[model samples]
Target: MTENPLKAKDEQPFVIDPIADTGAAKWSYFSLTFSLFYFFHIIAKYEQYTNTQLISVFVIYICFIALFFQAIRSTGKAVLKPIIAIVILSAVGAAINPGTNALFGYAAFFSGYYFLRKYAVLLLILNLAAQISSALILDLLSPYYLGPSLACSFSLFVYGIFSQKEYIHSCLQQKKNQQIEQLAAIAERERIARDMHDLLGHSLSSLALKSELAEKLANKQHFEAAKKEISEVASLARQTLSEVRLAVTGLKLQGLSGSLQKLTNELKNMKFDTQCYIDALNLPPMVESTLIILSKEWITNILRHSNGNSVSIAITTDANNVTLSIGDNGKTAKIKPGNGIEGMRSRVAELSGSLDINDDDGVKLTVVIPLLATVRSNVKNKAIVSV
Candidate 1:
């Protein structure tokens, strides 16, 4: 038979872990032991019952205990069947012995945990009705008996609601953590890919240019010039390999000042006027690395794409933020964001930073990153340790 959609939706699947299950079962059994007093009460009033009645009571108690263990161990939708059986068994056991009415509290607790709010309330009310009807039919109602039974059942049901909410909250938190981990891994992979492209793209282009020059010199029978070109190619290859190694190891051979100087020299070699400024401030390794890469990327873009012969680069820091601004005298009507721009944005965003592109006079890019608490703490700790 097919299950009811409403009932199926209301059920919570159990996680089966050996250690967790063992701990839960241990607590449950400890609590169940308290119910033994009811059995003791029955035995104490032995003179008021026949042998058949005692045997029936003992058999019912044993079966109820077995079902209770089953309910605790059961997983998934199967748990609801055993829980429902538990409720029925508790009602029957109460009819047989009014002292066993406490069993209804167990039923109410499980119902609240396994069922949705409305259904759990319905089950609690039904169990209470069953308890009252059984007590009335058997003429076993007492001021002491009914009040405590109802109160315990309600109290446990409320506890069950709280426990259910806590469990669901924990599950959501776990799922969120997993998603964050997965996203971090994806971002790392993208970062490596971008780094590789940036590192290799310029070097390979230089290699190709030098190789072509060497071939032309050889074709022209200028052995000396060709030899010189080949030597430069070999040196550039070694430098590229070293940079790749540094990228892989997540290290930078030069700090921000040194890297900016190298970039400015490169622009000068290309016959472009370059102005550069760097503030003397402590920077975290990640921020330094990101700025270095972005400087290289922007400089490369300027060399390859810009029409202007002048470029300006500035790095400045305030109390709360560090900013990098790069602009060229190249004329541009509109700015188009491509892979390089996207990569820069991604890198800046990872550090909770922002990137802006403006093209009013020439293409300009600005990156601003906040000195977050952790970064500031690291700077402070470094100063302390250095002192």
Candidate 2:
């Protein structure tokens, strides 16, 4: 039994954390300045240089800084213009002062990381073209320096491209884990609630019926019969107390079939296009209950978060193994591994099973449990429901 993934009492709502990273307050500015800072020493040696020459260097550096900052801040289509402008302006500067080659390389690094991969490579090519053209025209393409420069710059470009993607994926994975933790906690709480209800519901119902009969018998002056009814009520109370203790200790009594059948009807009522494919292999009690809870939580997540129109679930097993897979065509790329997912994983691990979640076009989860040698069998029974 899983608790509802909703507010119970004063529990705080789960919130997706902000993903934007603020590593440096003035990253773009510092990067541009440091990359060109070494070249400024060269300007001091040009004896024929006038005020205009120094001013040209300062003005070019300032322009690249502004453009680089803008390109860094903007994303997608908004960045296209600034990046192009920066590349062209850097080319002109490189023609005047070969030192601007460093600026061009740094620009290439950022472009490769931020832009679409195909477009990023194109920008890198443009940067190379400008650098080679400037070097050739100035007769300054020395093998000693050119070899190292090209190797280092190209490496930065490639590294930036891959590392940024990896970083984003890592961030997304962390966020997913947080979500799963939150959901799993909710499910555990819900499980406790269900246990309490099941333990008390039947016992209380029986208690009420017997008490009413006892009252009627007493009013009719049937003292002996009323006493017997009273005694039965006492027995029920004692039994109920024992059952409550078992439930509180996490001894769940609900079976797999009962829960699945109820879930199928619930999904139908909620207008979900759901299909269930179950096998009839007389699953072990523990395995059956675990799977039932997993299925419920999985479906609940779909209905609450997947925004999916349809879902397909399949359960199958071999001579010594069971495989269960559930998939939905929905925007699940953003779904994080919340508490519910974590709880499911922990339970499956205890049963010597594995669970994997794939996020491609949608969400698909596959769970495999290796049956014990004593429990493994070859019989097949399929229970499928589609609506």
Candidate 3:
């Protein structure tokens, strides 16, 4: 079954592995730094330069701050597009009016948003490219030196690319996990459907058919025989009802062996020599419940209709499927079609398994289940345990 989405195991609450944690931490740090730099830039830009003679410092400072924010934000595809657009727009504005400080300030804000909101390498690259392009296009000196600006921008771009790549990989991993969980959940639901049908349907149908026969006989001359039949049907109904209640109540959290033991006891109390022989096989809660319900209904049928004196049940693991067979040394009459039996057939179909009921000397019911339906490794292992 799928691990609980909202509730994790009590044994280990925080199960995020090192790689996942590292990615999250990296993203957080990137966002925080960008936020701080954005604030610092806003304050710095508003202040009047005390010494406007050395104006290159203003241009260089603004370029670094904007580059820092945009580089971090472009680590993911979601924010990469917007950041790239801003970078291009800023570069164009800078080229048109080379000496304007307003374009530099604007570019820095775009970098900050890209860094904090998304992980996209392209955003960082575009921002640095804009800075380099602007420096070359708006060179105040007669001679232009584009080499230094290009080198600095390229280095920052490379760093942002690596960070973005890691972030994307992490997201892909999480998505895969979620898909696996969803598949598990779908399988579990199918299993439950099959189990309920097998357990409840068979018992009710057998009881109903027997009860009808008893009523018919009562109207005829066989009054004693009719009463006997009616009594058996009544007992079957009561047992089935109890089993249904237990199956529904103990479904989510109960252990497999324990649920089976309860069923065995209930059957024994009703004077059916029901011997439960489960191998050292542990199963998931859902599988256990399904088996328990199936057992209850199967045994009830044997007692009421099969005229079986002793019943033996055996469960074993055969590769991926848990196989169960219930055999009895009782006489079998002509099997009649009923809703209960039909339901059992349907339930088995849901689990993608087969259920066969045979009557030669006595009635034998065999069930084949997939191993994936059960959680085996965690199950408590024990030899033959009887109740």
Candidate 4:
């Protein structure tokens, strides 16, 4: 089966670790020259081994050096062959030269922490034994700095553990912040809009009715009630309409990001997993507001009609155009055009954008506006969902 690109984003680690991104120093990583430092140390005791033994050890050491940085940086299954080769080479290098284990153990320590964490303890133990056994075999155990050597590897191990924790914390923190901001933007406007609309309509209707009745009462010379009603009507009529109108239309949570974030939470409540890929770049007020309204309407329609559980909302911009797509796995073969859909079309048409609806096994609502050239700049098409 073909994997969905959207689901791949979910499986990625959210944290950007400083160490893993750039391994060692540039010169050290590329040249494979760091291993030679240990080679010279073993060579200082030159008479013990013949030139043939030295050359063979050199050949083995070079191969081990080649994978030094990669072992630390690449713990993926793709690097499995190199990792196995390096582990064998590390043991062989230790037999020829005890100091070689200390120099190369950095690779195993870091790889254990980041990629192969489940076996980190075992790798560390084996690495320590490699260092110690070399010293004992060469009768150089007393002279060897084995204690500090092991401690140095352990320090890297400790840092790796914390780095993993930091990555997890970063992921959780991002998710928490996304939910809070989305809820704050979504719920605040919804609560006030819904409550005030119901309350104001009832109040205005009652006030208008009483004022007209008061007008009749004044003709019958019931002056006191008439005076009170006329005064109240005069005060309330202009005030209610002006305030309610503003509250209903003016105070929408601005920007495409916040608005879409809120809509995502709404879909989540309806058992729909919504992924929104809104860019960090700001759009023009008109463009942003249009998308904000359009996306909300799309989600609202899907929740009302669909049985599917997944939706992906994405916005992409290039040098000449801006495209917004909302897709769902719903039954769209018999979609009835309503005011909401009409309004969505009208809104896009006003901006000289085309609104398209695809109704195959699913529905995909796409709006492309070529009129917003200034708003569309160089932006990547990759989906950065929430975090």
Candidate 5:
């Protein structure tokens, strides 16, 4: 079976590590810092070059120093440093020596292509235009000229193509995470709405009916019957309150047996016959809660959609997994599932279980969850080893 795409957000780590992100930014700064110091040291000791050579080195050193400062200055704006540094260094490299310029320009182009994800294409275009124009200027000024610069310029363009793909993938990952979070929030909201509707709608309708019947009985001089009806109405209201509280607190103290018995009594009072059976005992609390939730949702779906008069609920557990199946005799409705089924699926998927719904012959929903025996055993062994 395919993995559920709507799994709970908290069950898995979503965002990449903040430390890892900070580390990458820090490394970018550290690399440029080292580069600036190394190049500056060379210029400081060997300043006997021609005026143009000294000027070119000075420009390159200043640009790298600026990049180091910018990369560390603004924690949130690290994207600009690589882009600016790459452009400046590419220029200085080309101006100094055609051969060396070709190499350094390729490096700078790739750095920008990889780091400045959003504007990668634009940076590549700009780098290409500048390098080509610089090559033409060099050809006019010196014999050792245009061909090498053109080759370097072409190399930078070609390098950007490969790095651009990686940059785009990073951009896509960031967008996908945002979308997942939005979708998870929407799913959680729908679940809450369904829980509220189930808790209130049935109880309110019953309350209204009981109130009407009690009033009618009192008018017919059936005071004792009217008093009894009032008590039942109060009991129903208290139980509904408890259910609402349980749903809100999300406490698993109400095990599968308690939850099912509650459902059976509630439906019986509401004039629907329910039969529940279990072949499991002392199940994991999480597994028991999962079963209860599944039972509640299936029952709710039956009441709202199937119009079924009878429901059969069965639960069984083996050493490795537990299964719960609920079936109703009434034919399935053609009505689409709104919130109930969606919430059931979400809860079951959180436990790494599968919920199967069959609309044929009768409405049947089945859920299966893995037992945690192996995990418990592993923990026990680890404890023993530590001792």
Candidate 6:
């Protein structure tokens, strides 16, 4: 079974360490600066302590600072051990001298950050209990120490929660961006495959037919006719090569009318009586490119499959839509959708268009695409440019 992404995210170890990162390290230094006040407080009253007592407090305070830094630098469960040590040192330091009570705030913050909510809360309660017990047992209970210590602990704990949330959000956003890039790459590859098929399919079929016609004429001793057919084949091959080059360079078809006329000539070559009609319409490059490619795909299908001798091609535009229809008086049969047909559908769908195929009389394809606002804008821009 596929694991839920949110659940997996919770299980993954954090990849960043606060103390090891430049920006986070600066903030760590800023927070650690506040802990110096307690260290200095002990120093200010050093005259009241014997040598043994003073040395013990100093050692405990140093160990607490070292462990605190280590805990922040560590990742995963490795951080827990040092954090637990810091909590113990905080309690021991408080018992030795109430001035070091502020150390418990640092412990509370680490526990909240490095653990889940329930575990962090339990650790927090333990820290509070340890502080209160030490103060009450040593007759050191005072509002001046207890009130500020509690406030600091809660404030830092909340800050830690917010920081953890921010980090998680950042990681998720990065993952989403990567997925979007992968999807775009796949779409681009499919587009190239579709374009190559439309460009080469018709040209290859025409070449094959012309080659056979030339060979038959040569066998009948009609040298001039055979030579003419071979010349046409060479010309068609060069044109196909140029189109492939332009397609690879991401350039759209330059002249829609010329392309349509060329298709009509190819139909006549196959002895098909073709009728063509095109309206005077201004279309955007992308729309024109899609129309030309779809036309090629349909004509190629007719040449390979149709048995009739007549074909009709029409392109017209009204106030609200552009329509393209291609039909042939061919033998009608069950139309099984193939890659070429599916590619045409995909192209039309991208323009928010509809395609219908009917085999009642003969095979006919009709496509209607709405006149989008962007298309109207392009037409207006072209009119201004012409003026």
Measured by lDDT, the strongest candidate is: 6
Better of 1 and 2 by lDDT: 1
Give the range where candidate 5 is weakest over 10 consecutive residues by summed lDDT. Answer: 378-387
- Lowest-scoring 10 consecutive residues by lDDT in candidate 1? 378-387
Better of 3 and 5 by TM-score: 5
lDDT of 4: 0.65
Clash totals, every prediction:
0, 15, 11, 0, 0, 0
Clashes in model 5: which pairs? Answer: none
Off by over 4 Å in 3: 1-152, 216-225, 246-387
Order the candidate numbers by lDDT, best to worst: 6, 1, 2, 4, 5, 3
Better of 1 and 3 by lDDT: 1
lDDT of 5 by residue, 26-101 (tens): 4444444334333443455565567787677667656655654543333223544545565557555655634334
Model 1 segments more than 4 A misplaced: 1-29, 43-46, 75-78, 216-225, 238-387
Model 6 lDDT per residue over 1-387, tens place: 433222333354332356433445577778887887676656777787788878888898788878877877776666777767876776667766677777778878777665656667787888788777777877767887788778888888777766656544544554554566568557766787788898799899999999999999999999999999999999999999988875664423245787788789889999999999999468755577789889989999898889999999999999888899999999867999988899999999999999999999988999998887534431100000000
Query: Which candidate model has the greater lDDT, 3 or 4?
Result: 4
Please provide, for model 3 over 1-387, each residue's C-alpha lDDT reduced to its tens digit, 9 standing for 90 to 100. 433221224422111111223443455445434323323333545454344423544554455456534443443343334345545654554443333323333333333322422322334455555676676667732222234334434554454445534544444545554577678667766776777899888988898799889989988979999989988987998898877776565555345566667666756776778888788365654565577678777777765765556778888876688888988887857677588878877776777778987888687889997865223422211111110
TM-score of 5: 0.40
Model 2 residue 10 CA deviation (Å) reads 40
For candidate 2, give the lDDT: 0.67
- lDDT, candidate 5, at 288: 70
TM-score of 4: 0.44
- The lDDT of each candidate is 0.74, 0.67, 0.56, 0.65, 0.60, 0.75
Ordered from best to worst TM-score, the candidate numbers read: 6, 1, 2, 4, 5, 3
